[model samples]
Target chain A: MLSSTVENYLKSLFLLDPRGEKEVATGELAKSLEVTPGSATSMIKTLAQAGLVEHRPHYGVRLTSQGRTLAVHVVRRHRIVELFLVNVLGMDWSEVHEEAEQLEHVVSDEVITRMDDLLGHPSHDPHGDPIPSADGTLPTRTLQTLSFCNEGDNVSIARIGNQNTEFLKFAEDNGLLLGRTITIKNKNEIADSITITTHEKEVVLGLAAAGKIEVEHV
Target chain B: MLSSTVENYLKSLFLLDPRGEKEVATGELAKSLEVTPGSATSMIKTLAQAGLVEHRPHYGVRLTSQGRTLAVHVVRRHRIVELFLVNVLGMDWSEVHEEAEQLEHVVSDEVITRMDDLLGHPSHDPHGDPIPSADGTLPTRTLQTLSFCNEGDNVSIARIGNQNTEFLKFAEDNGLLLGRTITIKNKNEIADSITITTHEKEVVLGLAAAGKIEVEHV
Candidate 1:
């Protein structure tokens, strides 16, 4: 019976090591969890003692198989709940993520399964992030950030690297939504800006913002 | 913002003083919360300092108007979530109370409002317990325990005073569900049992169990 805080730490570790192949730095986990590096180290130690994580003292920490399994289930609950809140409850997509953060810890697996069935077993959430299946299978999709594409290339939005509600709203307002086709118009490397044309409308995104928007070739 | 523990304490106080007119004994509150009397007293003191309850040492404690308002909202959330779990998710009625206990503390008001609308502003839950309105107005209806009804009287089950799943399952197994009409066949006062007939089947219940079931004259 893991506390929600412990579940959250495990989730952060899972997200940081999506491929489950590398040890993540304490600083990175701290930044992702919005906690101090000292706090992250303490929590990492606790998780290691519980056999959920392995702490490589001078390096960082990585999830054990047990930790990864628990983390996947938590992610599954989060994505399924987010989809239900938006599709069934008609909640704003930008807002549902925050609500799901609290709900994912409390809803039973039975409820999540019912929600998955109700939503017709969606493969991805509204943000285009893959929902880990009940059996812990994550989707393998080849995607590149918009910042990495050639100026003349055309691509479709796949997912946003950021989950911030403000960032999501900004993308939505500019028609940078998932599955929207966009042609790269110009790239000013020195200025750190990328210009794209979507549906006869042109929008300029900062290099940092463009890097956050992942895309696939059209 | 009150922690769920504080909220639970407040809710217990509210339920113990349904009429909002009397001070409930500390021992009774302790029993209701399943805590020791000393712990109940300590918590009552904390609640009193927060201005949510008034403590009368050697007597009891009562909810302040502020406490009652918050307690009613928590009740609204609990009943609405229970109805949603059973009605929308197709969960068993006997199972939803436990699930709702966890959900009520986490679901946001926005989500609850959506559920209320989806359920068409239901006034009563599946158990016939009145759901407090969003504005905190609890329905006023006179109801009495089945143990108080006279032998030969006909009544319809209104609400079950107990939320224990086992007790509910026992009632369901005996066809003693909410809204079921039954006629009192006999009352054995010394033996502490009441016999009732429902749908041509007769069932005998001890006074303790009968007292947990509220009914209305049909």
Candidate 2:
């Protein structure tokens, strides 16, 4: 009977350490979840006691394999629901993330599977995030952020690292989307902005914005 | 900010008195929600304090207009989700009721409206229960339990009063579905059994089972 709050914690931990490589500092998790340091510590202790997380005194915490499984399932539900909301309901991709956050916790696994099948087993959600497989594995795709691409490089957008609705809307408005080919025209290091051409339209994106858009070299 | 448990309580209250009529006894609500009388009394007090319900000590409780509005919305979500699960997802009708119970509390109003439109504004769910309109009005249809119908009366199944999965499955298997016209064959009052003929098939239903099937004179 994991509450949605607990599920959110597990998902956040998985997102912070996708490969389960190392311990994630408490302060880092606190920042990620936007909770106070005190609250994060208490919650980490609770998770550790439940065997969902491993905690070290004065160090950091990491998810156990049991916790990872639950987190992946939550991610699976979220992506499937997001795709369903956008594809089936004709909702805007910008608005589906918040709706999926609430629904992912309550929709039965049966419903998620139905949605997955209905959407033809989509590998990516509307936001370009991989939908975890039913068996709890995520599809891997190597990509670099637009900010890291060299000037004059040609790349195809592979994913959007941010789920912020406003940012996503901005990206969509400027023709930044998964699979769109873009040619880096200029990189101004001091101004922290990069210039790119997509389908002959020149667009200038700030460092923050460019970093949020991951791309694969073409 | 009401929890799903609180929403369930409000929904139970609305079901106990859909018309917002006279006060509903605490014991009746307790029975409907399968909670103990003491718990029901405490919950009613909490609701009364929150102004969603008016509790008359030793008398009963009744929903305020604010509460009724919220409850109606919950009911609307429940029926819409149930219909969506069955019609769109091709899920079993017997299983959808339970799924809708959890979803009704969490699905966003936007999602519900999309479902309502996708379903082409269905008036009733698969179980033959009326779906409350968005503005909190229910379409009225007079109906009575099959147990109350006289022998030799011709009736059309209007709705199923009980949402029990096993009973609903049995009713479905026996062709006791909404809008199905059947002729009363015989009634054995002492044995508490009633016989009906639908199409060319004759079926005998127990008093309890018959009571759960609502019908209208054809």
Candidate 3:
């Protein structure tokens, strides 16, 4: 019966350091959660006492193995809920993230398992974000961003690093969907833009936007 | 957003006095919520200040129109979630209630609307409890319990007034499901039991259990 607050903290910790190789600074955690640094420190202390995290004072905080497991479960719930909202409820992918945020805390593992079964055990969500398996292991796929693609390189969309709603809508509008193939026509470092050809049309994207679009060699 | 605590209080109030004609005693409210009388009184005061209830000292409390509307919406969410769990997720009817209790608080109006649509706007939940409309109006159908039926009376199960999980499981085990037709075989007032025939089999039940099974004249 962990509070949603505790779950959010652990989830944020896991996201901030997916490999659990580095401690996240209290200030950075506070900024990510939109809470004051003092509040984050106090919560970190509590989590340390509960053995969910190790607080290294001025160094920062890192989740314990127990905390990481809980955090991965939360992430799994979020991704599953997002897919269910879009694939079953017919909701837009851009709007489901916010809905899934609230639901991930309240939904039961039983319901999540049922949803996963109903969805045919999808490996990825609607946004191409990899869904953690029932055992809490993420898919191990090395992907390169569109920005790093060389001219004439053929690639297919794999995942979207940026989950902003506006960015998702823009991706949908430009037909840059998961599994869609594209060819890098130009990469102008000076202009900070990358031009790609998809669906028989050329689309130009700034380097920042291109970097958010993860792709795999076709 | 109303905390789940506030929503629970409102929901309990509505269930205790569905017609909003009678005021529910503070002691009764406390027992229903499994909270102390002092805690229930304090929450009642908060609800009163918010114009959700009219509290009469030493008498009882009743919901204002605003409060009743909110309570009805919570009920709607609970029933819809219950049906979605049972119908869509293939969960057992007896197990969905606890899951719905947690979910009804966090689920958004948009998701509930989608579920309602997906369920084809079902009028009643799996347990035969009428679902409140989007406008917060409940269906007005008067039904009689099996205990009140005369010997040889023919009726069909309409709703199970008792929502206790064990009772529902017992009902299921005995084939006393909604829409099933039954014929009263005998009424033993001295023994406080009723005998009914269903599926060409005679079953005997205590008056209390019989009283919980609401039925409609066939």
Clashing residue pairs in candidate 2 (N, C-alpha, C atoms within 3 angstroms): none
lDDT for each candidate structure? 0.92, 0.92, 0.93
Q: What share of the reference contacts survives in each candidate? A: 0.83, 0.87, 0.83
lDDT of 3 by residue, B1-218 (tens): 89999999999999999999899999999999999999999999999999999999899999999999999999999999999999999998888888899899988899999999999999999888999999998987889999999998999999988778998898888889899999999999999999998985788999999998999998
| Per-residue lDDT of model 2, residues A1-218, tens digit only | 79998999999999999999989999999999999999999999999999999999788999999999999999999999999999999998889989999998999999999999999999999878899999998999888889999898999998988889999898888888779999999999999999999995889999888998999988
Best by DockQ: 2
Which stretch of 10 consecutive residues in model 2 chain B shows the poorest summed lDDT? Answer: B168-177
The first chain of model 2 has a TM-score of: 0.97
Candidates, ranked, DockQ: 2, 1, 3
Instruction: State the DockQ, from 0 to 1, for candidate 3.
Output: 0.83
Residue-by-residue lDDT tens digits, candidate 1, B1-218: 78989999988998888779899999999998899999999999999999999998999999999999999989899999999988899987888888888888899999999999999999999788899999999887799999998899999999988888899888899999889999999999999999999995899999999999999999
Candidate 2: stretches off by over 4 Å: none
Cα shift from native, residue A98, model 2 (Å): 0.9
Two-way DockQ contest, 2 vs 3, winner: 2
TM-score of chain B of each: 0.94, 0.95, 0.97
CAPRI class of candidate 3 = high
Tens-digit lDDT track of model 3 for A1-218: 89999999999999899889999999999998999999999999999999999988999999999999999999999999999999999998888999899999999899999999999999999888879998989987899999999999999999998778999998888889899999999999999999998976789999999999999998
TM-scores vs. true structure, each candidate: 0.95, 0.96, 0.96
lDDT of 2 by residue, B56-171 (tens): 89988999999999999999999999999999999988899999998998888999999999999999999888999998889888899999988889999999988889988988
